[model samples]
Structures are given as C-alpha cells and as structure tokens.
Target: MSEGKVANSNRAEQREQLSVAATATDGVQVLNPAGEIDHHTGDALRHALDVALTAHPRVVVDLGGVTFMDSSGINVLIAAHHALTQAGGWLRLAAPTDTVMRTLQIVGVDAVIDCHDTLRQALAD
Candidate 1:
C-alpha cells in the first residue's frame, strides 16, 4: 500500500479508539468533545471534524465540555477550517471554556475560526 494509504488507515484506527461524538441538525454538524484535547486526543477531534464535514457544509464544534487543549488541538481546528473553507463551507467554534478559549486566542486560532459564546449562536449562523 502507498504511504498515504497506510497513514490514513492508521488514522482511522486511531479515530476508532477515541470517543468523540458528532451530531447533525439542519445542515449543521455539532461536534462534542469530552476530556482533554492534547496530542493524544487531537486525532479524535480531527476524525470527528472530518466526519462532520462529510455530512454538512456548516460545522459547529461545541467545546463547552473540553477541559484542556494543546497545539495539536489547534492544528486540527485550523486544518478543518481550511478544508471546510475550500469546500465552500465554514467551521464555527462554540461554547469553549475559558481556558480553551484562552488557548485558542493565544495561538490566534480565534481569528481564523469564527467563535461564538454559545452553541445556539453558532448554529444560528
């Protein structure tokens, strides 16, 4: 198999190991992540985001339940944002806890991904 295929297979396996859940409503997908989102959990978020993108043009990530996030998490969001934008869609961040919000702001991710104070607002937009 090609290197890219192998890597994708590995990613699929990894995504299966994580417990992220995604829901869709009115053409918008909402991804709810639990626990911490560091290097180990970032792939799960990526998979969830990828799945969301497949189902909807507008994706909203609900971060109200996330406790922590690292650079890996930020990278996943950035990549997802670019992918969605290129596909004529958009990614929205919703209800991020203070710490996660701060981390996103520190990395300047908030500027690239539209963030809202609540999921309702994100879904509405």
Candidate 2:
C-alpha cells in the first residue's frame, strides 16, 4: 500500500509540468519555460527567474512553448520585472503564443515590458 501511494505521488508530481532552462548570452540572461504555468508551476518559474537575476539584470523570457498561463504566472513576471528594473536592468519577453499573449495583453504586461516577436529581436534589443 505504501509503495502504491509513493507511485501515485510521483505521478501527481509529474502532472505539474513547467520546466525552465536558464542561460546567458553576452550580458543578458535568457529563460525558456515550456509547459503550463499555473499556481502549481508558478514557483518553479519564479525560482528560475530569481536565479537568473543573480547572474545578470537583463533577462529575456521565451514564452513560445508556454501553452497556458494564469494570474500566478503573471504575478511572478511582474515581480521579476520590478526586481530587474530596480536593479537597473530589464525583462523582455519573446515569442509568446496566442493564449499566453492574450493573458499578458489583458494584464497590460506587454505595455510595461517589451514584448518581441522573436528571440533574436529580443536579444538584439
């Protein structure tokens, strides 16, 4: 019974599918997150951003692979953007999908943070 419970727990953990790949190019930090971003997965994204911030101030978040997002993810991005700006850096967003772009638009994140159509554009700008 305990083994069955452990397996079920592992499966449940797997259901929270949000992964972040952090890297740096030139002087900017880039974070690529793939999967749904809800309350369950928001912390992972937040932690990744925080880690990236430690390396450099400017960050470009690649949202092309994100299929869905909720208020939690938005809040995280807002916090990261605020932190970056306060640190004399900025956060740019790259390649957000239609669903995620709609959410960002509704929240006016696009206005506050620069949103580019491509990663290359974001990196350049």
Tell me each candidate's TM-score: 0.84, 0.88
Candidate 2 residues 50-70, lDDT tens each? Answer: 998889999999999898999
* Best by the TM-score measure: 2
Clashing pairs in 2: none
Tell me the tens digit of each residue's lDDT in model 1 across 1-125. 69999999987665434367788888888898977787877888998888888889789999998888889889999999999999999999999999999999999999989999999999887
Most accurate candidate by lDDT: 2
lDDT of 2 at 5: 100
Instruction: Return the TM-score for candidate 1, rounded to 2 decimals.
Output: 0.84
